[model samples]
Target: MNGTICQSINQSINQSINQSINQSINQSINQSINQSINQSLSLLQVMEQV
Candidate 1:
């Protein structure tokens, strides 16, 4: 029926939106973690040089 088709389409759209949101959140989290880790590592190296 038309209602079932619409429901399925809506479900798929919601699923895709959730997936993309999760992916972006994960990417940003990882990027920030990497940035902080690199900063700390460089700081350690500088401390050792000093």
Candidate 2:
């Protein structure tokens, strides 16, 4: 019984840690994609102007 309790606690802690890591990674990936899209759009606009 005691061992099961410890395992459950460990699982929850691991889950939370994984969730936070995933969130940060997702945020960074999204930011980079947005930046890339914006840069591409700007470049296209400038090319058109030329």
lDDT on C-alpha atoms for all candidate structures: 1.00, 1.00
Lowest summed lDDT window (length 10), candidate 1: 1-10
What is the clash count of model 1?
0
lDDT of the structure predicted as candidate 2: 1.00
Could you give candidate 2's per-residue lDDT for residues 1-50 as a string of tens digits? 99999999999999999999999999999999999999999999999999
What are the TM-scores, per candidate, against the unseen true structure?
A: 0.85, 0.93
Clashing pairs in 1: none
Give the winner by TM-score: 2
| Candidate 2: stretches off by over 4 Å | none
> For candidate 1, what is the TM-score?
0.85
The runs of at least 3 residues in candidate 1 whose Cα sits more than 4 Å from the true structure, single-residue gaps closed, are none
Q: What is the TM-score (0 to 1) of candidate 2? A: 0.93
